[model samples]
Each structure stands twice: as structure tokens, then as C-alpha cells.
Target: MSKEENAIIARKLSKRFPRKVFPRLEYFDVLRDVSFSIKKGERVALIGSNGSGKTTLLKTMATIYLPDSGDLLINGYDVYKHAEKIASHTTLISPALDFQKKLTLRQTLRFFHSIQAPYGELDIALDFLKRMHMEYLLDKRLESFSEGQKAITRIAIGMMKNPDIFFLDEITTGLDVNRKEDLVDFLKENISSEQTIVMVDHDPLIVERICDSYILLSRGVVVKQGRAKDIGKELAYKYEVMVIMKDRPEFDEIVMLFPDQADDVLIDGHVVYFRAEDEDELYSIIERLRLNRETITKYVVSLVDLSNIYHALKPETINEIRTVEDEKGLPERTPTFDELQEIIRLFGIMIDTKSGVKIPPRKLP
Candidate 1:
């Protein structure tokens, strides 16, 4: 590819932080020799566990943190050498940073437009706000807004910049179902063939819907990288398989194949588990089971669902989960979108319980 077509390039990039104590403890290397390239118009997801260095890599790319070694270039400009010029075309949006709580929504957006484009494209900013359903909150101070509202506002402001490259860090953390769907639709509509977006998220559904490619990070290293579909397929192959049963087969067969790894599968109202060396082996067993089809009720590959993936990658938060469950008991009536909201809330609480990282509760105006 031509040099200009390469929107982002990092070669052996690394970052380290020194100890804060007086004795000067060991230097903690958050990122170690990480490198990757993102082409123009490509949407890529960065997936990893917490403390895997996804945020550190993004900060370095955004020029918020300088790499201790190696080089990072964005649109032909070295991120370290041309931080100001790069900022003109690059925007970073994350819950942890990028918004002014004291400013009213409209005022903060106007200020961002003035600083980024200077000519004050107020019309464009207002248009975007209206599109995001934030016009009603335009006059309210950001501090008074809910977490979901703030997240949506940040997205709208980022869109106003019409950045050539956008970096998103856990941007979907607190959004409700409707708002989340709206933001996803907005991303689909606005992300053009000329812009590059790098997203860091634990949400596989988001990755499945929006990302063209994915890079799996573990301990600050890229363990796998490929098209999003391919990654999903590979994960399915590695983790799940179709099963056929005849006359309500004994549970031992299922348990023996999967052993400890079969928690994801359910069959005939009973949890089933199995494991094979690979996809081929798993399929082979299925084929044999299907030959006797007299007793098979249903068969489908049981892959790791998004929630399972999230929990697998992150440490479990037992206390937070119990607290959320305790507060929001199982609904006695038919479940609705409101119930889904409560579930997501409980999920976040569970994460907090284990990690001690609180995900601020979201509210509505």
C-alpha cells in the first residue's frame, strides 16, 4: 500500500512507567514491543483483558503518551514529532477523559469546534447533536447528565470533528439498549471509506457488527489478528461443536468429550459438555452421532456467547454480582427492555465487584 494510504503505523512501540516511591522501584513496562498498522477506511477492534495495555497503546497513538521506544505514525506524521498537526485529524473518545463537566452540552461542543476547526461550524455541531437526540440536553451542564448521556454527547462531539482517525475506548460501557442501538446505527452511517477507526471494547456484539477486522491482545501482545468473521469462526471452532443424540443418550459421552470445558452447551433441558482436539475432531463425533438420528431432538454448535467471553477475559466480580442481583430481583412479570437494562446494570456491578473498578451508573433526564 502507498504510504499515505497507511493511516496508522507503529513499529516496535513500547512504553514504561517508573515507580512513584522515594526508593525508585522497578520500571513497569505496560507495552512491550507492540506493533501494527491500520489502513485508511479500515475499522479495527482491539480486544483484550483489563491491564492488557490496550488503553496505553491508544494513548500513545493519540500522542497523549510518548512511547519509550519505537515509532508511531499517523497519516504520514510522526505522532511524537507532529502531535499538534496530528491532533487536527485524530480524535480520542473515552469515558475516562475528553469531556468538560462544567460546560453545558452545547457550550462544550461549540468550544471543541472552535478549538479544532476554529472557524466555528456551529451549524454542523448542532445538526449532529440533534441527530443523536441530545438537543434536549444541550443547555444542561455535563455534570448533571447521566453516564449514557455523557457517552452519547462525547460521540456527537467526536463526530463533529469529522476526524480522519478515531480512537474509541470502552465507549459503550453505560448505554441503555435504545441508545446503544442508536449509536451503533450512527457509526454505521457516518464511518466513511476515508476514515480509520480503532475501537477498544469487550463487547463482541459491537465488534461483530461494526469492525471489519480484529486484533486480540493478551498481556500487551497481539496473539491473533484477522477479519472479524474469521476470528469468530475460529473461536467457534476452538470452543464449540454440534452434537447429535439418539434416544436421549447418556450424559457420560457428552461429559467425557468436553470434561471441564462444556459449560456453554445445553441440550434437552440439560447442560451438556464436550471437547475435541480441534474442529475436525469435534465434527467427526457429530457426524457419528447423526448417523443414528432416531433420538436427536436438536443439534447446533455451542460457541462461547458474548457474556461468557467477557467473563472469561476479565476477572469475576462475585460480590458486585450478588449485590446487583439482590437489588434487582428476578422480575415476576414478562421481561421487557427495562429488564435488559437491569441485567446490564447487574453485569457491570459484577465486574466492579471483582475488579474494584466502578462503572458509574447511568441515568436519564
Candidate 2:
């Protein structure tokens, strides 16, 4: 392919990390001969389970780490040989704690501008702050800002430089619903036809919403690459429906409202239905049911339901479903306790990785 046609290109790019404690410890392969090309103006999402090399690939594209083998080029600039030139046109928003705590938002931005452009281009910085709804917090010390505030500030700083390629590593962490929506709006508005964006997030929901394309990584390899909408459609075939109830009151009410549907309901678990149209109708029904101020706490329509998808997609994942014959000899399995725990954990991880929901670690007895 022509160099001018590609925004970023990786040809068999790979990375290896040496182990710390032994004379001959095995080198960990963080990335393995991954090759893909991103086009200008395309919004691509890199998704995987933890340790699947999404961050490593992004860092390599950002020229933070040189590939152990193969080649990576950003806008025709060799990532290894043209690190400085690539740095000029690429920006990476990592999770590293690098901001100055003592400096206020405005002061910090000014400092970054001095280093990045140095020619007095504070207008873009100011505009970004304004777009983030963070202009009012400009004078507040970075140390005093909340996690969400810090995240927004970092994003604003990254955008100020107007890099040709933007690599976002879960940049929406710690943001509230309103702030998240605002940031998404800003991204949609400012993304130019000449710029490229690559994002990594565990939550497919967020990825599906923002990205036009997706690359699914598993065990340091690209397992699937295609349009995001196509992947969603494939996942929908295997997903089970979930009806969440807050307590016994809501559960009882749900049963009373739809007795026939209740028979298939797994009570706090997910149910599989073959028809997408029925699922849509069920979602609407649930919403209307909640409109009456009924004691319904929460209702959700999951496309693939995380647990089922994880097990179906990842060979390493353990399946919890056991086949049993019903009264008519139809086979089914009740979702087990372990399955519920895994599903909840997977959901939490996806949310935290995508939105920075800091869930505390589970306590072990």
C-alpha cells in the first residue's frame, strides 16, 4: 500500500519483555507479529481481556516502545528511526500519573504548551478546556481535582497539540454520565478528516458506540478485525437476555406483570431468546413498566451478555452451563453461582477499564 494512503501501518510488529528474577527467565511476549493498517479519519477500537497486548500495541504505535521485530510506520515515518518526528504527530493518553499535582489546570496546560509548541498557542488549550466544561476549574490545583477532573484535564492537554494520530488508553475513566456524554460529543465534533484515532477499552458498549471499526485481541494475537456493527451482530446470536431486579418486591412485581415471560426468566440471571425483535419489544415493555413508578429498580437489554460472550469467544474461559432435560426432553442448564460471580466480575472490569469505575478488590476469606 502507498504510504500516503495509510495513517498508521504495522508490519509484523512485536515486543518482548525480559523477566526480572532469573539468570535465564523466559522473555514475555507482549506483542506477537501484529499487523494492521489504520486509515485517516477512521475511529478504531482495540479490545481484549487484560494482558491481551492492546496497550502494548498502542504504545508501540506511539513510538514509546520499539518493536522487537518487524516494522511500524506512522504517516510513513518509521516508528523506530523517526521517534522524534513521530512524536510530533502522535499523542498518547496513557494511565501514567505524570501531571504536576501542585500546578493548577491552567498552569499545567501552559507548561505543556511551552514544551510542545512553545510559540504561544494557548488558544487551542483554552478551547479544549472550555469544551470539557473545565474552564471554571482552571485555577484549581491539580491535586485538588477529582479523578474525573484529572482525566478531563489530561485529555484537554493531549488535544491542545492537535496531533495527527491520537491514541486513547481508556481516556474516559472517572467521568460521570454527563461528562462522558460531553466528551464523546466533543470527540465527534473535533475529529478531522486528516486525523486518526485508536482507542482501547474493555467495554464493548463504549467501543461499539464510538468506533467505526474494531480489532479483537486474544492471547497477544488479533483474532478478529472488522466493522464494529458486524461484530455486534455476531455477538447478538449468542447473547442471553438479562432482567435485573433490585429486591424481592421488584421481582414479585415482574413475575405478576408477565407470568408467561416469568416462566423463562432466570430471576437475576440472563435468558436466551432466538428473536431480536422480541428482545426489543421486551425492552420497551420493561421501560413502560417502569414509567408507572413501579418499584422496578433496573432493567437492561444485553446484546451478548458478558459471561456468555466471554466463554464463547475465549477458549481460556471456563463454561458454567450444564445440560439438563426439561419435562419435554428439551435441554437447558440453570446459570450457576460461579457463573453469576464471573459475569459480575467481567462486567465490573469492562466498566472500570472503559469508564474508570474504581471497584474495590474482592475480599478473600
Candidate 3:
């Protein structure tokens, strides 16, 4: 497809933040020369481990964050130059979006609806809430509602704008079963064919069901890309065979036996995992182990899932994702997106914190 056919494009985009290294200041790169594109109306999933910059990349694409280097174009317009216009066309839903706990759901919806939509649009937003079965809780204080109720409320408020592009950052994580069903029903019925959705979700089942393609990120870089069914081939069959053995010898043997399907086979120390795409494939793998059960300590045939992908993307040497608890003095990384927004609200001014300098506003086209 041509460049004009794409909804969003990132070319060698890079972003970094300043960090204190005891005696001096150092820079930590969050995004490193990232490049990717999403066609208009396509549903795409951002897959990655912790601290892989998935959230940061999503924020950049939504124009909530800007690239320090390279170009990001949304609908053929430079995001850095037309940030506001691009952002207005997209709505991001995540756990970071919080409502006032003291207010009733009715009051909260009206308050944000007045800001994001016209008077008549309130009914449309209410319709979504009703579909989610959250209208009954409208008079209840937000603080008393369950996390699942809060989840749907966020989407309802976000949809008030009727954005063209939806950017979801792990929106389904904390939802209860009933609420999750409601959200799924909403996605299936409410979303239009022409609207685009970019999401960051850990559940491979949801990703495969909702997304057409996926971009896998690792340490702030695109490590892999493929069709959604390639999520360990979960669409064909839902079984995984994990054989416990020793050394690369078994790993090599399995690879040799299943040369064509080697990509579905993976080994990490004492465990060898086989991602079966079908029942025949699942039994074949188990049958192979049965033939050599004397040498095989044991093997298990369970449901195929996203664990292999996560293991593949696991950092080779990284210890762990640092958090606020990791810092004894100042934060290890820059303030989070919510923190920065709060700062801008209360302080009347905020800096990027990368260079400790105020950023000039971008001019609208």
C-alpha cells in the first residue's frame, strides 16, 4: 500500500529521558530508532514485555508524547507539527485515566461529556453505558464501584468524543469476567469498520480475536511482526506440549524431528515447549515423546498460549523493569504520562524533563 493508505507511520523515531547516575546525569533511551506503520481501519496489537516502551510508543502515536528525533506522520500530517489535530482524532483508554472517586457516575459522565462533546452527545454516551450494563450504577459514587465498573466507565467517557482512532493500553487487565464480557460485546457491536484500533494487551486470546496484525516490541524496539493467528497458532488448536528434559541434545533432537515445525518448538534449559496448531499436531508431538519416554522424564500436553512469545521477547540480560521503589532519591526514569499531566495542571507549567527545559507549543496547521 502507498504511504497515503497508512493511518500512522513512524520513521526512525527516537525518544529518551535524562536519569541521574549518582555523581552525574545520564540518559535512558525509551524508544530507539523505531519504525512501523499501521494501515487505516486496521486493528493492531502492540506486544511486549515490561519496560519495552509499548506504552511510550502508543503515547507518541496518540501525540501525547513527541519524538526527540525522526518523523511520525498521522494521516499524512506531521504529528510534531499537528499534534493537537491528530490527538483530537484519537482517544486513548488505559488504567491511567482516572475519574474523581467522590463523584457519582452520572455527574462524572456529564462533567467530561460537556468538555469533550456537545449537549446532544450525552445521550449517545449514556447509550454505551447502558449497553455495558453500567447505567444502573450511574447514581453510585465511583469510589464504591468495582474495578470492572470503572473500566467500562472509562471507555464510555472516552467514546463520548467518537474518536476515529482508539488507542487502548492494557484496558482489559483488571476487568472481572462479567465486565470483560460487556466490553467484548461493546467492541463487537459498537466499533465501526472504518475506525482504527491500536491496543496493548497481554491476553493473546483477546488480541487474536480483535486484532488483524501485531507488532512485537522488546526493549523499545520492534523485534517481530506477523498476522494475529501467528500468536503461537492459537486459532487452529488450543494445546501445548511441554516436555521436561536435559541439555541442548533433546532440544536439537526435537528440532531435527520436527524440522518444518521447528519454529513452534522452543527450549529453555530443562523445559522444551511445543506449540501445537492442531489436534493432530498436538498428538504427533506427544507421540514422538511417547516413543522415547525412557529418555524423557515426563511431558505434558496442555493449552497452547502466549507464553512462548513472551519467553522469546524476554530480555537476555536485563534484570527487571525498574519502578518508583527502585529509586531512593529521584525517579529512575522521567515522570509517567499521568504524572506529567498532573504537573501541568497544578503547576501551570511543565518541562519535558529530558533536558529540564520548557517545550514550546506546536502550531496548528
Candidate 4:
């Protein structure tokens, strides 16, 4: 409701990466004038397609990637001016941790923990690692660990920080069913309501377990954001009916049949997806397709999921972002490889984990 009540405030935030594509270096814009405010203590899911800038926005907000222009305020601190401060309070756990270094798991965890909490207790963190059944790998080199082991170790290290803001990027990647469920349950029970969690997870279980709200991104733009239940209302639908046809000969005919629901029809090869606002609508669509069973393969119907939301979003142009940057007199220059490395090193050096309590924090009452 107010500035003080917000945990993150991003205004006109934009970021781009220089890609060495064949003949010349091409500038690819990842985030374009993205603006949104996340309320304090909200467990919000950042939903978007593969290349929709979800990770970029999360890293930028956590002060990992410096924005070329625009302002980002997290927990009342200007990210640019307070990048070091923000890094201390925020912990970003990403797949980048999937390294095959020669160091053992124990050595890696100790190194990171000492960087943040030199006097903290490692036994507490180890106890939680035991819960994930990864304690046996403590002495094993990272090179010998499986993808799942590396992923679990990363989670253990990141959680050791006990940051005020936890940023999870594809957290469910490489995790097994039992361990994934255990980690989610432990976090849901331990993380206090005052501590914010911003995650990008595709697994329905994670979203259903923790996410109360979401921010949907489409091609580097803030397309939609609100409470989780509000997404269905935005699309004017409750359930999704995906009809798999042997051949899409009836695709155009189906579209013509429901001209009023033209926008709701999303065609992917032989699969035609339909939005049903209610049971009656869902029933009608299903029956109509059954008449053409000779041309149909099968059908699938379920509640609206994040992937469905991403597909339904219309992409926007980046010309407006370019025009705004030109008006602001922002110069377009790519940071050198060395400069980028130095920037990251500075981020590492500036992080102050001294304020954190012991790892594997006690459950808050």
C-alpha cells in the first residue's frame, strides 16, 4: 500500500546482453522497462516462458546484474547506491552453482559460510543437509557428485545465509521427488512471513505449496501481475482443454465455429488448446470435438497453469524501450569481459554475511 510497505520497487528497469553472433556482436535486450512493486513478505512466483527474462529480472533485483539504466529499490534501499547492502540481505540460488570444481562439498560449504558468517555454527547447516540425505556427499569432490547432488548442495549453502530475501531460480531443477518435497516443506515451515521469497519454479507443487501471488513476464515486458487466483479472471477462463488431433485439418474449422472465442484458441501443431470459463463451456467444447473422433487423437483438460498463461500472453515491441533510452541520453556500450568479471568480484567482496544468525535457523513461532 505504501513505499515503506513494499519489498521491491522496480521502475523502468532494463538490461541487455551482447551476443557474439557470427559476423558481429549483436545486442539482445533481455529486460525492457519492466516496472512492478512486490509487497513485503510476499511469496511471489515470477512466471514467464524460457526467454521471457525471468532470471534476468530476478538477478537484477538481487543486484547480481547491474542495469544499464532505470532504478530498482529492494527493501527501501536504492539498488544502485546500495548494491552491496542489497547483496547482504538477498541470496540468489541459481543453476550457476552447478560447478564441477575439484573441491569437496564440505570445503565448498565451509568456504561460502566463512565468507558470510565466520563465527557461525556449521553443525546446524549440516543437520539440514542430512535431512536432504546429502550428508554422505560432504567429503566427495564436486566433480564426482551427480547433478542432483550439486543442486542440493547449492540449496544447502544458500540457505545457510538465512537472508532477508531469498531468490530461487529454477529451484526444482535436478531434484528428486522425495528431496524436493522435503526441501519445500522445510522452507514453508521455517521461513518467517516477514522474510520475502521470490522464486521461478515450473513445478506445480512448488507454486501450490508456497506462492500466493505471481508476476508474469512476456518478451522482456511486464504483461500481468497479481494474486495467483486472479490469473484465471484475467484470461476469462477457469480450465484449459487441450485437444490433440491426428491432423490439424479441423483447426481452422474449429476456430471458425467459435468465432467469439477466437482469441482463446492457441494452436500448436496438431494440438489445439481451448479455454473454458465454466463447466458448461468445457463440456460443450469437449462434445463438439468428440463428433470428429475420426480426426482426433485424444484430449486433455486441467486447471490453468503458468505455461498456459505464458502462451496466452501477447508479446510487445522493444522500440518503445529504445526510444525512452534515447530520450534519456543513455549511451549504449557493452561492458568488457574483464569489466564484467571485476563487477562480479566486487559483488562477492561486498557481501556481508556477518549479520546472519546460525545456519538451519529455528522455526519461527
Clashing residue pairs in candidate 1 (N, C-alpha, C atoms within 3 angstroms): 247-295, 257-275, 258-274, 258-275, 317-354
Per lDDT, what order, best first?
4, 3, 1, 2
In candidate 4, what are the lDDT values of residues 303-347, reduced to their tens digit? 865554444432221111121233445534334335433442333
| Cα lDDT tens digits for candidate 1, 1-365 | 77888999888787887746567665656676677888999898887777778898888888899999888899999877899988888888888875778889878987888787753356655766676678998899999998888787777777778888999988888888777777788788867889899998777777667788866565565544556444334333344443455444454555455444343333433323343447776676577446545555565565433332333343332112221122335212222334434653665432223222222211111
lDDT (Cα, 0-100) at 337 in candidate 1: 32
Candidate 4 residue 138 Cα shift, in angstroms, is: 1.7
**For model 2, which pairs clash?**
none
Rank by TM-score, descending? 2, 4, 1, 3
As for model 3, its CA RMSD to the true structure in angstroms is 13.4
After superposition, candidate 3 runs with Cα above 4 Å error: 21-25, 118-120, 229-273, 276-281, 286-308, 311-365
Model 2: per-residue lDDT, tens digit, 1-365?
Answer: 67788898888777888755476665666776678888887889886778778898998888878899998989899887899988888889866746979988878988988888743357766876787778999898999988888888888878887888899999888888888888787887877878889998655555656788867675565645656455434442322444444445444555566554543333323322211235565565555556633544555455543233333333332121122335754332323435434553554322223222122211111
User: Any idea what lDDT model 2 has?
Assistant: 0.65
Q: lDDT scores for all predictions?
A: 0.65, 0.65, 0.69, 0.71
| Root-mean-square deviation of every model | 13.9, 10.7, 13.4, 12.9
Cα TM-score per model:
0.69, 0.70, 0.68, 0.70
User: Which runs in model 2 stand beyond 4 Å of their true positions?
Assistant: 118-121, 232-242, 246-365
Ranked by lDDT, the better of candidates 3 and 4 is: 4
RMSD of 1: 13.9
